[model samples]
Each structure stands twice: as C-alpha cells, then as structure tokens.
Target chain A: MKSRVIEIVNKTGLHTRPGNLFVKEAKQFESEIWVKKGEEQFNAKSLLKLMKVGVSRGDKIEIICEGPDEDKALDSLCELIASLEE
Target chain B: MNLKDYLFEYNTISLQAEANSWQSAVKLGTDLLVEAGTVEPRYYDAIIESTLKLGPYYILAPGMAMPHARPEGGVIRTGYSLVTLKTPVAFGDVDNDPIDILITMAAKDTETQNKSAIVQVVSLLDSEERVQWLKTAKNQEDLKRIFESLTDFE
Candidate 1:
C-alpha cells in the first residue's frame, strides 16, 4: 500500500473538469485508488463518486493506492494534483 | 415531460462576448433570464455569487456543462437558459472544459417533474451528435433545429 495526502489547490476546487481528469488518470493505473475527503471515501476512478464528495479548494484529501503499481500510481496522481491550475 | 417545452431558443445574448470563466458562465444564463422576463437584472449577480461558493461543478458528462444554482438562491421560478460560449473557458475540469455549451437551470423544487426535465436535458446532452450540433450552431434557427430534433429522438 502507498498513500499521500495533498490539499486541493485549484481556485474552483475539484468541481467537474479536474475531478474527471483525476478519475481518468487514476483509471489508467493498475491499482486500487481512493480519494478521502472528510468522512467520505470515493473511488478515485469514478467521476460520479468524486463529484458526490464535492471536494473544494483548500480541502485536504488523502489518496490511497494499493496494487503492483501502487508506488507509480501514487506518484503520478500526486504530480497531477500538484500541477492543477485555475 | 419533454425538454423542448421547458427550453426556448434564446437568440439574443445580453452578456455579448464578454463571459470568460465559470462566473461569467452563470452570468450568461441569468442574462437570458432577464431577457426572458423571468427574473430581475440583479439576479445575475446573485446566481454568480452562489455558484462560485457552491459550484464550478461540470456535471454534464463529457463535453457539456449544466451550470445551475440551488432554488433558495433567488430563483423566481423554474426556468432554463442556453448560452453558447464564443470561445470555451476552463471550468477547471479537463474532460469538461473549456465549456462551449452551458445550460443554466433553476427549479421550483426537487419535484419528480423537475428531475425528469433535468434528466431529459442530460439525456439530450449525452448524445454526441446533439452536442456536436449545439457546438457548431451559430444562430437561433440553428439552435432551434437541434433542440426541436431532440423531441423526435424521444
């Protein structure tokens, strides 16, 4: 298992577009990835699940990855979140 | 329960080539409300403020954006407006932006009827050809053609 926590930085937060992007990216990795915000945990690859959590800007979210490519999966997602712009 | 009855062809845009972001996107919708006489001019600011606080949520599936505000935020009645961005602007969601088609909706309540309208609109948008036609449509007649054709599909 590999995990990292990052605060959402985009001005509009993880509304729809970025949320979908994150989901699309997570689906590519052969790992089980989940995004945690508050008490809610969502499958990182499901756009609907991500939207339901309604992650906003400055919210701290935990990304958990498990599988053979867990390390690479976590790293790529961290990079993606870090690169988000308004 | 058809979208055509609820949606009309908004030919004139009061915002007029000025909107640039998610904020402006809501403004475009409210501007249509004013033109349609559904709400007051000041209502535009109210919708923008609320959506900024609550949204930027691009929930229109693939290439569309259904920008809306909750009914408590001064929605006069259940209403719908359409705005085609002259150039798309990012709503912060990559798969969704920069959005070229924005359908601003307001409902009287979360009634099944309203939900059905939303579903119908979403279904219309989900169609790739309809979305494509909406994207390339340049005038009211063109938009009307696309929207009217949706009824036949149902």
Candidate 2:
C-alpha cells in the first residue's frame, strides 16, 4: 500500500464542488483509495462517504491506496487535495 | 442531529410524489423545509443555482440524491427534507442519473453534530438493498420503519 499525509488547503475544505471533484478524481484510479482522518477512514470513491466524514479546512488526512496502481493513486489524490481552491 | 427525528418532525417525508422535471423535484424537496421554517424561500433558489452551475453534483448514488447548499445560503436552521418521487427524473448526471429519492440537507456548519446527519443517510444507503428499500417505500410509516430498521445509524 502507498499512502501520503496531506492537509486540506481549500478555505471551504472538502465539501460541495471540491468534494465532488475529489471523488471523481479518485474514481479514475484502479486502486482502492481511502481517506483516513484520525481513527476514522472513508472510501475516497464515494462522494457521500467522503462527505459523511465531514472533512474541513486545515484538517490533516491520510490518503491510502492499495492496488496495482497504488503509487499513482496516492500521488494523484494527494495532488488533488493540495490543489483545491476554496 | 437524529435523521429520523429531523425528517419526521417537520413532516418532510413525501412518498409517491410526482414531478415532471428535476427542478420540480428539487422544489418539492426544498419546499418542505421552507414551509417548516427550517430555511427561507431563497434556499430553493440557491439549490437550483448550484445544480445549474455544478450539474446535479448532489446526486450521490444510483437512486438517491442528497441536495444541499452552503449554510449561509439562507439556512435558518439545520435540518433535512426527505422526498421520494412517484417517478424518477433525470438530473443531467450520466452516472447517478434518474434520481428517485432526495434527502435535502441544510446545515449550519462543518461540525460533527451537523455532519452526523449525513452519516445517517450514508449508513442507510450503503447497500443496494437499502437503496431499493428506501426508493420503493409506500408511505410515511414505511419510511419511518425503514429508518428505524437501520441499526447502524448513530
């Protein structure tokens, strides 16, 4: 498994359009991607699951990817979160 | 934020309803909250504007769509409106299209208390069987029983 820890930089965190974009981007990968916040983890591919976790601004979450393209999945997800603008 | 309590309190559960278009479906859902004083009239407008700009991004699953807008977009209180259409309508979404159930949310903030409402919906919709169960509900009692049946909701 490949994983990376990143902080949500967007002012609104991961909700609304940003949340949709994150899930859509995660679905592009063949790997199983999960976002872990503290003790809780949510499926990165499901928009509702990710939103249910209630990600907010400045929250640090770990993106864990496990599959054939785990490395690519981790990098893309990390970049996606880092690049979100409000 | 009890999903069952919040939905039933405002009498927001609408089952076997009819709407010709996705916008009407959204109006029906948002109006429930509007009448109950959970939100202002502009809340529905906000939802429509966002859907138009974002293209039905609220359509979360195969038959379910949890429509919501930002808290400042005329939300007087944090609540939800549950609407189940008699016939599904297309929301211009290619993947999770033709939404049948819409749980419209109006939250005050990003706190866990508010987000737990979302978790309850996700819990009930986590399985296809549950999705079908909610979609085919005949009445308000059926809807209440369905929410009660979900033991995982907390």
For residue B143, model 1's alpha carbon misses the true position, in angstroms, by: 2.1
Cα lDDT tens digits for candidate 2, B5-103: 888887988888899999999999889999989889999899899888877877777778888887878888888888888889999877778889898
How would the docking of model 1 be graded? incorrect
Residue range A19-68, candidate 1, lDDT tens digits: 75688789889999999888989788866556545677779999999999
| RMSD to true structure for each model, in Å | 8.3, 2.1
Q: What is the C-alpha lDDT of each candidate?
A: 0.67, 0.82
| Clashing residue pairs for model 1 | A17-B93, A17-B94, A18-B93
Task: Give the 10-residue window scoring lowest on summed lDDT in candidate 2 chain B.
Answer: B109-118
Over 4 Å off in model 1, which ranges?
A1-86, B9-18, B40-43, B112-114, B151-154
Off by over 4 Å in 2: B110-114
lDDT of 1 by residue, B1-154 (tens): 2445545543333222446676776777777766776566666666666456645554455546766555555666666776777777777665556777777766655442133435555666755788788777877678677767765455
Candidate 2 structure quality by residue, lDDT tens digits, A1-86: 98888998888677666888888889888999999999999889888777777788889999999999999888888888889876
